[model samples]
Target: MPSTSDQTLENQNDEELNSLHGKIKALRSVTIDILDDSNRQNDQLDRTGNTFTQFTNSLFSTSRHHSRSMAASSTVRQYRTIAYIVGAVVLLWLVLKLWSFGGTRSVPPDGVNGEYRI
Candidate 1:
């Protein structure tokens, strides 16, 4: 049979080992929870990244289309301005020519007496 001192030491050793085992199990559970949380965060980050990329692509395409339209509109406006300028110049030239030709004519004898000049 074992002595009293030996038995006491054996019991102490068993208690220490049991405590260590319990601590190890608790640590394993905590590590598993940390790993699960990390995986969830990674998934969320990927989704957010994808959404941002799509939005950026859409914005770029819209801006490109608007720029093209604006360029076309500006070209049309330039043509219209040129046409108006040319028309005004032609009208002024015609009016001046007509005025010079009409002023050089002689008046009739009936209109020279007391009637207003036509």
Candidate 2:
């Protein structure tokens, strides 16, 4: 059997409690929304990072292939130059040797003073 004044005070306390509860619920809802937005941002960042990685990988692979092709082309050119140089040297040597062998005059068929004629 509470007095009227005590009952009024209890009612005021109950109203205050309800008000605090409502504020707590509103804060919780706002916090949840913020967390959800943060998660979405994180997911988007992950996707962007993956896409960048893939692009870089492709670029690197293409560059590697190009480098290899250029190296091969350089090697072929070097080999061809060396072959041409070697062939030219060999041809010059053969021509010089043949000229030296063929240029010496042999003894003439008619003898003059017992010496062969040029």
| Model 2 lDDT tens row, 7-47 | 99999999999999999999999999999999999999999
Tens digit per residue, CA lDDT, model 1, 15-92: 999999999999999999999999999999999999999999999999898678667787787678679999999999
Q: Which whole-number lDDT from 0 to 100 does residue 33 have in model 2?
A: 100
Best by lDDT: 2
Residue 53 alpha-carbon offset, candidate 2, angstroms? 0.9
- TM-score per candidate, in order? 0.59, 0.59
Report model 2's TM-score to 2 decimal places: 0.59
Candidate 2 overall lDDT versus native:
0.91
Query: What C-alpha lDDT do the candidate models reach, one value each?
Result: 0.90, 0.91
Off by over 4 Å in 1: 75-118
